[model samples]
Target: MKYRLFGILAVLFFLAWQTLDGMVEGDWGRLEGGLANLSIFFKESMWPPNWSVLEARSYPVCEQDIEFFCSVGYLGMMETLKIAFVSTILGFIGAICLSSLAARNLMPLYISLPVRIFLSGVRSLPSLIWAILFVIVIGFGPLSGVLAMTFYTVGYLGKLQYEVFEGMPSEPLEAGRAMGLSKPSIVANIVIPENGNHLLSQLMFMFEYNVRHGTVIGIVGAGGIGYYISTYLKFLQYDKVFALLLLIFVVVVIIDLLSLMVRSFVNEEGDVRKPTWLNTLLKAKRSKASLVESE
Candidate 1:
């Protein structure tokens, strides 16, 4: 069994390596100076990131007492965050409505199939394409970003939600059915509560995804930090772009921490014991250790 597994993995690895070599046209020598070139480029053009993006623009005439509030970083990041939040909410609601209709356990095959197809159609187009389409229709702004992300969120989340519904234990659903509960009532009182953890998880994940993609859409004049990043790129201002990139990294990390905190409320751990600030701040391993000790 072990030898068979090793052979399968070896074959997969060989295939992947051969495919990569073919794509590169076997020009393996081209990688010799890659590290040195990257090092030189970074030191010469990207080191010592410019901090001016954190201060109010000269032409903006900063009215706020705190100049940071008027800074490009703050304004742009806030706009991106707003777009992400709005889209995540709208998408979650839309996805729930559709997913309830599409789940095989909840609906007949004929009913579920069409809804599933519709979701697939929505999900087929990447968010970037949706952003471009909306940009053309609305002439570019945060609104365009929101609509694009919202559409994508519906498609992605709908699939996840219906699968969660179908995978749930059959007992509660059967009990609900025996009680002559309406489909809406069963969904509202049973399916959602049972899958609250997963739903919240997907919601948080989509919000983070949208926030990151906001930068991409902004490049096409959709509005956000990406617009400014695009401007800096046009002028070859790598230092400013690097600084903005760092800001985005920090924001994404913060969002991840927030996701952990939010999901803690609905997850199994929450049922075992109420979440505490200490648990939220602790590493997962340490939290598990503490939980074990406490128990």
Candidate 2:
């Protein structure tokens, strides 16, 4: 019976995959003919990069404008970081609250289903579209970026946290209630601690995701490194565009490495060696006054 079920599933998977593949191929056929036009397009606009800006030749094409772009580029990136970090913090908190209510063992279908639908709606809209909406509502610049990042973070974290909640054990939850603990108390003492690492890991993951989203949101005038890169491309400043690409790559790689460290710290809590300073912060803050008062 198991073998038959597996064979049927495998055949269905293959057919479904091919059906989607054929649909994509049909669309690609329409664009494939125009693919060669890119070469012709580039040939018509021969824009050489200002590589000499680093040294001689005195590439004096809009020195003031270049300076402004460089400054604004960094500022825009900083604004993006601000938006991403702030949105992630608020969104992660909101997700936790929603997840507690979304968990099947914890909440009713009427509640969880609506929340799930809401999250789907949030994630369904592309970041660019979100930015456009925000621009209409909040006006342009970093405000739009913040709103877009906020929704994205909510969708991503709520989806992830709900999964964590679903995987949670029932034994402790039942035991807590048997002991007459309130639901909130049970969640705080049992669920939150048990899933702290997972929550933090998701927060970090969302941080990285929103960082990339920040850069892209700026293309819609939401403000980020993309603003500079796009402007440079508009003016045919290939070198500046290339510089933005390199810088974004480095920033993303660094953030990825930081995320890996955070994940390792969370997952390897039992195996990690002791630290002097970094480890001290993780030690639960205990008040001597409380201990003395209790004594």
Candidate 3:
């Protein structure tokens, strides 16, 4: 155990040394000076957020101006949300189909093995690289972002869904077969219902992740809030950049809360209970009463 601990520490120290060496090689001499300037820049640019800027509209000066003159910040935010939503939904559909085929218990090795390999290949690439590839193929737009998110979602959700399906109780599936249910019927009636809550939870979590990723993909000209973020930072408009960052933060928080609520509703203890704090308290009280009565 002591040797194992020492080996782990040695590896960690080596990694840290390598990282520091890389940073120094990349020129750390200016970093200290740059940090002081950065502090001043942040104070001047981000201290007073322009809340009214999101509501301000640009006057139409040209065809392109007319296309995006109304509430630039809000419109960008909406586009980001749309990209995340559409990609997640499309990817989830694709994942469900692929997961059914990929489950080892449901399909033979010949069928499932190839699918597992394909999904692994897909999962190997990061979403940013996928976005860049799509942008190269399709040109700069939300289409690239959507395609990137969709493909990444399929890779991620497929693996998780197949694992869930494989771990599911096989007794119900056998019972369905004995009752003369078809394969599709058995999966639809038995497998899905048993894992519905878990699947939904995973989907919601993926959507939340995609929303955060959507903002990043737009930096590569994929057309969302990230595009504006990149633009503002390039022009040194740190106030606008900070505002966009705050907006993204708020959106993420809201989605996280909604996902939590959905999980609570679907995976409620015992029966299908209301996902409310009061309901939780009520359930606790009832359980305590039942225990007393039994005693």
Candidate 4:
């Protein structure tokens, strides 16, 4: 234990030293100067937030003679949503197909082992790195972002789904086999229905994650909100940047609420219980009503 602790500390110290050396080589003094004026910088950049950017009318309209017209921020946001939505759907489908073969309980060792390894290899790299590679190969655009997100999603959702499949009770499989059901029929009719809610939950979570990733990939010219963010930051337009950030936050919150509602519905019983907090409140209300009736 003593030697292990010493090794860990030594590794940490070496990492810290490397970080400091890189900072020094990259002119750490500039960062220190910026930190010293951080308050001033925030005051100048974020004060009197120009919320007019959020108003649709604030966007410029092209002349009637012009062939096209669009708001940059609005279009960028929509594009980001599109990239996330499309990629997530494609990824979920791919994950579902691969997961059946990947599940150890559902497939032979030779088949499942290779599938698991392939998924692990795909997941080893971050989505940003994948986006960069796709950008180089496919050229900069939403296509690159879509492909990157899809690949990452497959690696991610595949692992989760296969585990879920593998963990399923053996009773159902045994019963299905006794009934002479084929493997494909057993999986489709029995396993899928049993785990429908979990699969949907995973897909929703992945969609939320992909939305955030979509924005980051756009920074590399994948053509989404990140592209607009990069452009605004380059021009030092912090107001617009903040506006876009706010829009993203709002959208993410909406998605979260929607997912919560859907999950609640999927898990609902006779009562409309959902969102644990709300369920508790409803239970309290019912208790109060029962006491009043008894009185």
The prediction achieving the highest TM-score against the true structure is: 1
What TM-score should be assigned to candidate 1?
0.95
Consecutive 10-residue window with the lowest summed lDDT within model 4 = 62-71
Model 1: how far residue 210 lies from native, Å: 0.8
- Residue ranges of candidate 1 with Cα displaced over 4 Å: 288-295
Candidate 4 stretches greater than 4 Å from native: 1-38, 55-69, 268-295
List TM-score per model, in order: 0.95, 0.72, 0.79, 0.77
* Candidate 2 residue lDDT tens string, 180-274: 99878877899888898899878888888888878788777887766766777789776656655666676777787667566656565435443
**Model 1, span 152-171: residue lDDT tens:** 99999999999999999999
Candidate 2 ranges beyond 4 A from true positions: 1-73, 269-295
Model 3 scores a C-alpha lDDT of 0.84
Instruction: Give Cα distance to truth, residue 11, candidate 4, Å.
Output: 17
Candidate-wise lDDT, in order: 0.92, 0.73, 0.84, 0.83
Question: Which residue pairs does candidate 3 place in steric collision?
Answer: none
For candidate 1, the per-residue lDDT at 158 reads 99
Tens digit of per-residue lDDT, candidate 4, span 1-295: 9999999999999999999988689665567767658777767896655565544433355443422225566678889999999999999989988898899887889999999999999889888999999999989999999999999999999999999999999899889989999878988998888888889999999999998888899999887889988888899988778877888888898888778767767764425434454543365676566578789
